[model samples]
Target: MPKSKITETLLNSTVSKYRNLLKFCYFLMVFVVISCGNDTKSKVSADTNENATTETETEAPATTSSKTILFYGDSITAGYGLDDTNDAFPGIIQFKIDSLDLNYEVVNSGLSGETSAGGKSRIDWILNQDIDIFVLELGANDGLRGLPITETKANLQAIIDAVKAKSPSTKIVLAGMQLPPNMGQAYTTQFKAVFSDLASENKIAFIPFILKDVGGVKELNQSDGIHPTVEGHRIVANTVWEVLGPVLNSEL
Candidate 1:
């Protein structure tokens, strides 16, 4: 072979090998860059997921503890004639409290035909549970029965004393009552004064007359002419709420 032709062939082979080497290096760099990008994305996605999980694990639910309002009364508080006792004033008040998002539980500890003397006897048992607010609604039956005014007053006072002794912090709300004219002018007058006098003496909250607008109104009362109808109870709830609302709000 001629020397010039052999030299040209060798140079051509070397050039081809150098070009192939350059191409191989470019492909390896491109593969490494793509792999590194994919690994970075995976790490970022993993970090985001871990942060989300940590936040969810650390988060807590909100909770609230409910206080109690106890209505210690007679047939009026018991919703005697109503099909559902929820229509009673105490339950209506509970609905109002819930609507306002106030955390309070209303307990109606009323008994049908409960009188001042009866209330005095059973007060200790009712006081067994904690009472944030205590509403006393008695003496109406006593007045209706034409019982001795002095005895009724004494019984109610005893109940009040028992409550104070049991829980000094418990707020007492004295619900006043009045007797119909048939009970006698002097007797009725004395009965009406009983609640007011006790309230003043004890320095407690007082409802002048729990029945207020509902008492003498014929439409308000049920067939018994004594126990309030559902509508009547609603009105009574409003009257009670006027006084009770402030006390509850103060606690809040």
Candidate 2:
């Protein structure tokens, strides 16, 4: 072979070897970049899943338990003509219980136009459930209807006796009421006395008048002049709460 031709072949072979080496290096760099990219994606996916799990846990809510306090009465307790029952005094009391995170559930057993006699008839059935605190708000209807004061008093006493019989440990809160002067001064006086006398006799807690600030206030009452307005119920709730709060807190 010619010497020049042999040298040229060697040069070409060397250049080809260099080219192959360059190609291998380029492929290795690409493989490394692809591997790194895959690793990055896996890490990002794991981080996203972890964050989602944490968010789910953080967004969960809380729960409530069962025990009962009952408000038993006539239209006032029933929340007559109110837009929402919750806007009534009983409902307002319930909101307080919830806000305070107290364990007792407030039950409104108010019936529109219910008299003391009617309450006496139904109280036994009401006592069927265990009542922790009982608020008696009857007699207003009896007074309004001009029912016999003696009969009303007797019925109320019977209801109290029944409560004691059913749940001796149950705390009672009596709500007093008054009649307009037109009902006659003597009857009005006697009607008002019934509550004090009973409260003292039974040794139970008493609210002098559930409708103290609420009653006789034009804005506080509904159009009927009998049921209280939402604002009125708020005031009534405050009154009941004054007596009932201490009882509940002590009991709890």
Q: Per-model C-alpha lDDT, please?
A: 0.92, 0.92
In candidate 1, the residue pairs with backbone N, CA or C atoms under 3 Å apart (3 or more residues apart, or in different chains) clash, namely: none
Each candidate's clash count = 0, 0
Q: Per-candidate TM vs. native? A: 0.76, 0.74
Which candidate should be chosen as best, given lDDT against the real structure? Answer: 2
What is the per-residue lDDT of model 1 for residues 44-150, given as tens digits with 9 covering 90 to 100? 99999999999887885566667889999999999998999999999999999999988889999999999999999999999999998999999898988888889
Query: Which segments of model 2 are wrong by more than 4 Å?
Result: 1-65
Candidate 2, lDDT over the whole model: 0.92
Worst 10 residues of 2 by lDDT: 60-69
TM-score of 2: 0.74
